[model samples]
Target: MTVSIWQSNLPPLREVDFLIVGAGLVGCTAAYFAAQAGRQVVITDALDVALGASSRNAGFMISSVDVYYHHAIAKYGHDVTREIWHLAKRSQALWYEFINRAGGTVKFQRTGSLLLAESEAEAEDLAQAADAMLADDLNIIHHKTDPLKRGYFAAIEQPDDGAVQPFELVHAIRQQSGVSVIPNNELYHITQHDDKFVTAYTRMFIFKARQVLLCTNAYSPRLHPYFINKVVPTRAQCLVTEPLVAPVLNTCGYSDYGYMYYRMTFDNRLLIGGGRKQNIALENDTTEDRVTDPVQQVLDNYLKRHFPDVTVPVSRRWAGIMGFTPDSLPLVGVLPDMPDVGFAVGFTGHGLSLGAGTAERAVNMMLHGTHPGALDAKRLEPAV
Candidate 1:
């Protein structure tokens, strides 16, 4: 059964030209774009805006994949990897445009991102990664000394990376005209109608639309059974420390290929998350607010090891679920059997950086039957 919780005290559902399930970053932005096209659109979610991974995320706008481009090239070929990199760059630009147009203070910070290497071998790998990215024209530089002055690991800084308040951006986009967002409304079933899609929710209301898009991420399996096996849920634990007198991290930092990431909020607070692989089983669920002791312990040790002098008290601690596919790339395209239905999910925790571009490409595919070079249809195709 689905649940319906409206953000604003609004009336019941109504027919529209497009119905988007999961009003996260991707869905809400897609709604705004579609609505601006003079299409009547209704966006629904099981929770309030940004309540899912979109809101719970650390808000880092990365311009690379989970793995480095060299690694991706090795696994998926250079042509495919180059296309992905280009998509990320375009997505980063779109994020800036949205933030500027919304006039929302999403704390857009373009301080760049640093990937640290804890060992010599890791440092060598980082160098290779930087070289590959440079060859592809990405603005990534490999540095030996720690830029944050926190002697943790050798780093590679990507100057194009930035961060934003995910929830604020989502809300701002929702405020646009022609886009109606219904929160706490869960979509259970989607059926095809004549030139339209029928979406059934547990609220006993059926929504009619010319098209439907699924952007549910980790919890997507519930709405589409095929995604259950294709997309796996992974939990990421995050905690924010009270505003420090002198922020230790001026730029976002990631180590171990994003298993551990920490960044300084605009308010001078340290926001850190990851360490899911430590408690893989416990982190393999869809629940949004479960913080395990082991996960927290790893975070604590990381803090102590990295910032030995900083004595910042933890302000907030929470957990968010991110979707993972067999490969790390996201699935963004039309489903095989469902022509009127399209989707963008399984971001593997990289959605914060890549979601906007993915959404734009997905929307383009739905409207014009073509996607940007960044999105690989084969990678996004439903598993056979």
Candidate 2:
């Protein structure tokens, strides 16, 4: 994404109050919050709005990390896990508010979500997660047997989680935020000139801004060296079948330990994603947004094995890059050398669940110096 000398000298430098990089979900959400704070906000993106993973995701708004609840508590502690879950809940609430303001343009449903188990072992894990969630007084129902009768062994249903039209959702947020956007403009370099201003070099314009917040997610590493090892780009593949006569899945169904997920689109198309579990070497650490044969083949097998009723041809197939963090939590912090350049990236494939809330926290920290709690990047620093 480097800007060459030939492409760099088109426009004169401009000054902005607040500059946001990446116009996807997180970036737009950040713009929304920044504008609410009365800062003139501008968003710039390489591709246009919601063209990346934000719109390309399966659109499940599950209020948890990429892993099961108990596993999250095991990996990060109980308090941290609870706080992350609440963050996701807050994101969903914000999304609902935006959808309400969309005036029927955005399609969404509160159909809830089911975390299904593919095997006995996974079923046992679901039970454990259910116990942990119940102990925390979280509203979840555990079904000892598969409710979908789709060959799953067990399930955990989160009534609060739901499905969304991701592309429309982002556009709605952008429109509601009332922020001017410079589309198809990619940021190549950014630096803090002084405490009062940060300079950014982009494909279209050089911007000197009072503050900058990067919601670039997967592309953050390419924009700056600070995100190098902290935010690793990973690819996720998905496909959708031609419309079916009747609805097959009534709710968002997640399986294979949250790797594979499927749901019925608003138009009755069956959309399914996640085969990277078997093709990790091919899919990991790559930003290429193109689907490969191996991963798509696994998805095809999964569809046929569990959803034999779905015989329609695939309408479309696509891939999107996600930012994966080492600890499986989104990071909120400023660049070590550039203190005013704040960032909220590394959603680890759970952007829809965590983006809005993390964006709010990131905006507050950058403008009001509020601590981001569990999502603070200082948590990742090595202890002496």
Candidate 3:
């Protein structure tokens, strides 16, 4: 007999027009907007909600790009990159809008972010990128400032950018409009039919719906083979320091070409993360939720490099896996053969910044069969 993914855990799924897999920020946001539009939605996750990349981040809600403006302009051209940057800004705005509407205990800090440039040449590039953003009438402050103890060449001060408790936002979105969030109910597999999809869940529960959106992000490759070539799982290490006696990091900070980032939590704790580029081979791992000593050492010693005065015991350290794409953009449309199934993945570590807007775009595509150029089917077709 073939063993079932779940033993004696028979749960019933009901009246679900939209079955969304993965209860991270992407999946939860999908459920949020889908139900907000008066659609019956059921969302499932392998683990508890927000336990993935949704919560395991530095929690900067800045509209900054993973592929920064300079690099993006070079790779995808100026026009396409500008459109992508606007979409990223819109994604951050989605968080703020939901936080206001939720009217609950959501932790959102409007702490502006500083993108640092270490070298004079790099600073010039940053200045140009800032000019591009300013030309579009977006909020931007470009100047040479020694904000950090480690003297930087220049910085792009994004005033509208801020930080948010990503887990709270994910939870709040689900809580809105009675979306069914089946946590601890892992989706082991998905069977795509000609007209619909049948999902296999842990605890012997299954659901069929006209539309199924795979918002699983990193683990999306397991359910669909196409993602095996498109999306690659990458590990990100993060840590939180013991409460500081005085405020150390005032606003969200990024440096070294967006490869590293740090921020201050509400309780005067410093949360720092992002060092995958430091050790590409080791950080590319996604097998476990544990942090490697090499990356942890980088976080452990980063304080001395920037703020020598602030010293605190390490409170906690952990790691989470996120999906990456070859092009550093997300795949947010249906597969070529699977008409009834649509999906989104490969955020390239900018999931929080892009999840909500991309999820909303997925909903629009599913509903009206079209969407804005920023997140339409043609831009992110998995095959391409």
Candidate 3 lDDT score at position 68 = 58
Tens-place lDDT per residue, model 1, 1-384, is 333465222335557677888888888878777776667777878877778888888888887776866888998899878777777787788788888887656668887888988667777888889888778777778787656666645788888788788888777767753577777777776666454555444343567667888889888787767686678888889888889998776688688777889888778888878877687887885655688899998888888888777697889888888888877788876666677888888888888677888888888877788864545546655488
Q: After superposition, how far is residue 289 of candidate 2 from its true place, in Å?
A: 0.9
What TM-score does candidate 2 get on C-alpha atoms? 0.97
Writing each residue's lDDT as its tens digit, candidate 3 over 283-384 gives 774647788999988877776677666677879998988888877778777866777678877788888777777888887877778754544445544363
- Taking all chains together, each candidate's TM-score versus the true structure is 0.91, 0.97, 0.91
TM-score of 3: 0.91
Worst 10 residues of 3 by lDDT: 1-10
Residues 125-237 of candidate 2 have per-residue lDDT tens digits of 99999999999999999999999998999999999888999999999999999997898888888878578889899877899898999999998889887788889999999
- List of clashing residue pairs for candidate 2: none
| Least well predicted 10-residue stretch by lDDT in candidate 1 | 1-10
- Scored by lDDT, model 1 comes in at 0.77
Q: Give candidates' CA RMSD values in order.
A: 3.8, 1.6, 2.9
Steric clash count of candidate 2: 0
Off by over 4 Å in 1: 1-13, 193-199, 202-204, 371-384
Model 1 error, position 279 (Å): 1.8
